[model samples]
Target chain A: MMRSDDLVMLYSGPDQVDYAYLSPETAGVYQNKHGSFQHRSLVGKAFGTRIRASNSDGWVDALAPTPELWASAVRHRTQIVHQLDAAVVCFELGVRRSSVCAEAGTGSGAMTGALSRSCGSVHTYEFNEARATAAQGEFERNGLTNVTVRHCDVCEEGFRDLDVDSVDAVFLDLPEPWRALPHALRVAKPGARIATYSPCVEQVHRTRDALSTCLDLRTLEVRQRDFVVKDVLLETGLAPPAKRRKDYQNEDDAPRRYANCAFLAWF
Target chain B: MVDAGDEVVLWTSQGTYLFAEAKVGSTFRWTKRERVRVDALIGAPFGATFEIRGGALVRAAPRGAATTVEDDGERRDNRWLADDNRAQRLDADDLKRMRRDGASGEAIIDALVAGSDTFAHKTQFAQQKWLRRKQNKYLPWVRVLEPRAATIAAAYFSRGNLLPHRVVLRPDTVAQLVARANARDGAKIITVDHSGGVALAAILERIEPSGKALVPHRGPFEALRRCNLTDLDRRVVCFSLDETPPPQGDSLVLVAKTDPIANLDALLPLLCPSAPIVVYSDTVEPLAAAYAHLQASGLATAILLSETWLRDFQVLPNRTHPTMSMSATGGYLLSATKIVVADAA
Candidate 1:
């Protein structure tokens, strides 16, 4: 197990965008759109094998891998996890360093990057033989001995491990996570945390229903909105209040005001 | 910062004077010729007059470069301050000269900030830093004003039309380029690309794939095109701004400028009072300022500036204008029966 300073997972838009803030000095992990992480830096930064989440979409892009472990793992393809979702999951779940985790439907090794960075070990499952093979290579390249990819459908081949009730976290990004809820319940400890990502509401409902028996799911959804801000002059003498009031009350609650709403959000 | 609807005159060292409403809560700079633009004849301790017009500025006939010609008589250097005249008395001639001297509205703001500083040294340093930074950041934007204006005009004229002449992008963005595009008849949809030109090309490809994606390469001929785009069964014509003058036939519609402030300024002369000028923006400040200016200037009887533009200041709106519509939140249309007739004709 690799022990490092505060493990950071920063969310960037996608790909190793050249103009991003991740250039060296700033070391952590960058997630691609396909949910894969890659270790990147300005030539003078980083040590050991570069670990990145692998995906079918060429989501992982690492410059030069110095470590033998990273070179080997570079060939794998798995569904990598996005930095945003990963950070949210890690924080909300209160994951501890060196904790054992379970992940299902490893598309490209994105979530694996997160688990590998924060936990002691991860047992990831992938049904696709080709994907599993790719993931295996990535594990070797990153020199990650802790994360082991098993080539079996988590739903069918029940988890067989040294300990059943000691897993720290469980994450599912499959098409239908509800199907894996039963399997998740069987393997999870009493209060182990679980997280899932689904685009559609129908799937959210199904997963919520399926996990209801085993997990006491408190939080439901995460929504993000990006907006543009405009400054409006507050008519006349209200300048003092407008300038002093840092936190604005909703216009419905105010008499004199200036306002505009411009933003788009995604769930 | 000056509020919207506040009438102010700007002077410059250029021949033409400018009389423009503040479009944003911007500050002025202490660069060369800025004094003529903002402070007017105020700091000319030697006493001087100035004029303003069309946002440009110039100094009026000068009495003398030196007031009290005592070489060592401790004459207060007027060059370090504004002349005695206030912002209200600035006229068109001063604005014209200021424009000729390349003065900007931003200069007026820098002057105000400089004037507020308690320490003279600190004020000079701050103004200098601001001018340097602003020059570096806004040069690219100022250079493309012409083309940007044309693109906005085209989009504005195409409002309520189909997806061919008009296209929606970033349905998720506050500007709602897609929402407005979808709502308009004949509106076409396009995805956002990292490069602005690439995004425009993607739209053109969907409308006409005949190697016309090289429209920019088509030179002056780019504006004149045999358009065959249709949406919701309405006929549409697609052309680039550099190539096409405003559609000069009867019943034709024209888009003005992508820059919201300039766009409104152009529309003020063309639009009729009581006509709805729907405005939208990814941020509300520029649009609000424009709306307030239009209303206060007696240009429009009623103006509707949407509350949508105040989204995020970071994501600069594409400044796309929809035709035949006051911008819907600054991206909507500025409508008037006579204006439409005039533009179409």
Candidate 2:
């Protein structure tokens, strides 16, 4: 059962997600396109729990918050990392429950949300103070105690200020990750897995040049699966239109700032 | 350090992998001349390399395993080469005799190259390609990797005769499927795996120390043992679908080698409203039926059916291109969010 202060991901559609913080004191109607429901009514309901909207006549399911959902629903303080890139990065980095990870230039705290859930603990460094403070507050609100948001330029000084010298994995979402490779390698454990997300191909070449000794480097561009399966029925209310798969991407059409491509290298 | 009887994937330097147990008295045969006893690797750490020295397995020195030696040999170009089936001078019996005498993989490769009528005359690019293809077969050195889900799935994929529908449930695709399921901590994930246990292992790796997964498979789930997962009793419960009903879950996954229509009918009821559902199949016929059923029934919305094929690029200084061989298919996946519809009754 869900308790007050537990982070809840309320869903009205597959892609439509909204955050709801439950408290008995702030008893009011929670509103979204799905419907409106009383905040107090959700206090004792089970998770993956459904309740009818008192006003919109539609319904929403109360589900547990995951990194994928958070990536979709979190307020876009900056263009967040796409879930596809995040998934590939998480896997290629080999992060697990026992790993310690570090990130640079925490843009919008989006990728950090993924890294936090994937590994044991994350020490995220952001160059911007405002973004750093904002992400810290957001993590606290979501009750994520395993993340630490610090205001530091990792490219400038390295991951030394946080007092952690070595980590199991490292991720760089900065514009110029070549400068931080030496610093990242310094703190990364021997045989640590490292991945970088850059928007351009030239950055991949420059990043590859920084580690000339590494062998058998692989570069992958994981496109979102868009070729719609043929011959599936589509009623008017169920699906938007049967025209094209690009139509589904209209919701996320806003220009994204970080994570255009991924460069993964094993050391 | 791995102990005795631990399962490990013996990874070849040339990119072939197989699952083997570090048993006390068993022998792992990579090739005729590379049957090394497994007892020496009993306590060696994972990622350690083992070589066959006098029929005994022993830790071998790292073979530079570094950068691919880029040698653009300019001796001869292959413009005049013709494929009339007489390109190799070594006949079948000669090759058989060389193998019977226990020639090393490298020695065999050298003999083959020397005996070839057109090998030295081929272009640098063609020569490299030929070397790479031969290396996959003749390389004898092995690296011991932990037999995790990814490794096991890769090893199974390398050893073929697989159902096309099951290929998408391989390593990279499994990661994407888990994301599509919206798997999280403490959430119940119901899986119907027909691809051995790739889907289950992918989810378990990410949501460890938290969630519970119930797998309804038909057999003994013998493949799950290959993953060598610890704490399996608490995290997963296995049963035959004919025996009992599974608890309702937040998400559903169906990767069926047979038709997925039957599995979806049985598992869809356990998913709550707004739960994400992912169905994988190599053919669109079965998934089309399953997709239409969910759509016409008003049981799911925001439904998207799609498939993806990944191409890997080799990044080298002067010669970068897609690898010579690429997998043509990753299969189809039908995904949707289950929603509640008011009953007309």
Candidate 3:
């Protein structure tokens, strides 16, 4: 059951996601492009209820909050890790519920939320004081008690400043991750894994050079392409497709475009 | 650590693997000449490599710590090397004699290198490639991998869906599906696993500590036999698809091998309001139909029908490029949030 002050994700429609903190004290309405519903109206309702707007026909689904949806709907303070990279990184790190993991430069605490959700404890550090404070506050408000956020330059001070002595895995999303390798190694247990995310090849080269002494280092990248599922209806004068006309067809527009095919749904 | 009767994954490479029982008095043969007894691996820790010697398993370096594919030096190229009979001086009788003399695989490789006329002329990468091929042949070694959900999924995935009974999910798809479901922590999950048990095991692996999973046992409950489950893991409640109502759950996951359009009808009623719902399928058309069905029926919101495409890269010094081999489909996932507009929804 969802308690008061719980963070709820409001799904209004396609690509329409909003957040509603069911704060009992704050008597207000959550207004979005899809609709506006009174916070009082949603206070005690079950999470999956579809509530209609008081003044209009607009309605939204009040769904339970999860890290995956939060990442998609979070207001970006910085470029966060998407599901594609996050999935691969977590799998490569072999993260588990018993694993104690740490992360550096917790930008927006997006990946930090995921780590805390997946593992036992998360010691997330950020060099920037503002981001760290905001992340800590967010974690607290979200009831993520298993996470401890710290504001320190991990490259210089290291993770030992916190209570964490050994970790199962550590992820670095810093600009110069090479500078933080020694600190990462200090807290890593035997057979621990480390992951560094770099968009460019030069940073990867520098990081590899710094990590040359480590055993079993692998350099890899993963990509995910989403295909829109739809129905294609021929332009023939027969009865139109049963589904909505807005559903576009999945077309391969590489070589040549077909004229008679009416693509409908873009899922 | 593995115990007797545990099913362990013997991994040599992505392309070479074998699933074997850890019970003693059994033997696995990798090649015509390479075979090892299972007794030595019964109590060994996962991720440790053991070599086959004299038809018995012996401890080798830990898995990946002694990888031979890593080579940086490229001072010499194959420009001066000729693909002729003169490159290797070792004949068939010489190899047989070396084997008869009880030379280890590494020693034989070293002697072969000493006798080769062009071993020094090959590039570092070429030498590493030659060494890997020869080492795997003469001195077979395999890492004893724990049969975790992710590990099992990877093993089956690299095998390219050879078994019809196993789930055809790629590791990427499995990870993403688990992420989308948000089944971590102590959330109650309603899972329908058709990929034997790998799908259910993956979810149960995440909802740790006090988490509970209610699996609809359509047929055989293979998870009990296939996975290394503790007492807590067996807490996964089972119900028939027809007998008991789909247990009310905070999360719902269906890795269906069949069309999901009808299964959704039976499973959607008991899902807790406002929970995440994830449906995975290997093919796209069925999932597309399911997406439309969910949309038309208004049983779901915030639905996104998407698939994951993976491309592997071969990273080596002066040999960095995308791998030549890749699977066309990593698997597809339809992610959405379930909603209720009525009582007990």
Instruction: Note the Cα lDDT for every prediction shown.
Output: 0.38, 0.72, 0.74
Q: State which candidate has the highest DockQ.
A: 3
Q: Which tens-of-lDDT digit does each residue in A1-267 have in candidate 2?
A: 678877787776646778878876877567887678777667776665666787766887666676777777888877778777787778767677788999987878878888887789998988888889999999999877899888888888888554445798888888888889888878877556678777666787788887664433567666545443334355567656656654344454332333244544444
lDDT of 2 by residue, B1-345 (tens): 678878778877667876778888887776675566788888887767776666677798653233243576556766787879899988889878987898877898898899998887776666776776665566546777776555666677676565453443545666678777876666688887777666777777777778877777543444567767788888887655565454778889887676677777787888876688988887777777887788787667556666655667666555666677877766777887776643321
By summed lDDT, the worst window of 10 consecutive residues in model 2 chain B runs over: B61-70
Fnat of model 1, as a fraction? 0.00
* 1 against 2, candidate with superior DockQ: 2
Instruction: Report the candidate with higher TM-score, 2 versus 3.
Output: 3
Off by over 4 Å in 3: A1-4, A162-165, A213-216, A236-267, B1-7, B13-15, B20-26, B32-34, B38-45, B62-97, B114-120, B218-226, B242-246, B342-345
lDDT of 1 at B224: 20
Q: Residue by residue across A1-267, what tens digits does model 1's lDDT show?
A: 112331222212111222122433346455555564433322322221123343433222222221211212333354344433443444344344446788887677766765564456788888999998887876665566778898888777756562667686787777777787777767777546687766555565566557544412332332232222234555467345644654434432223232111111111
What TM-score does structure 1 among the candidates reach? Answer: 0.29
Interface CA RMSD of each prediction in angstroms:
28.2, 3.7, 3.1
Any idea what lDDT model 2 has?
0.72
Q: Assess the local accuracy of residue A154 in candidate 2 as a C-alpha lDDT between 0 and 100.
A: 84
Clashes of each: 134, 0, 12
Order the candidates by DockQ, highest first. Answer: 3, 2, 1
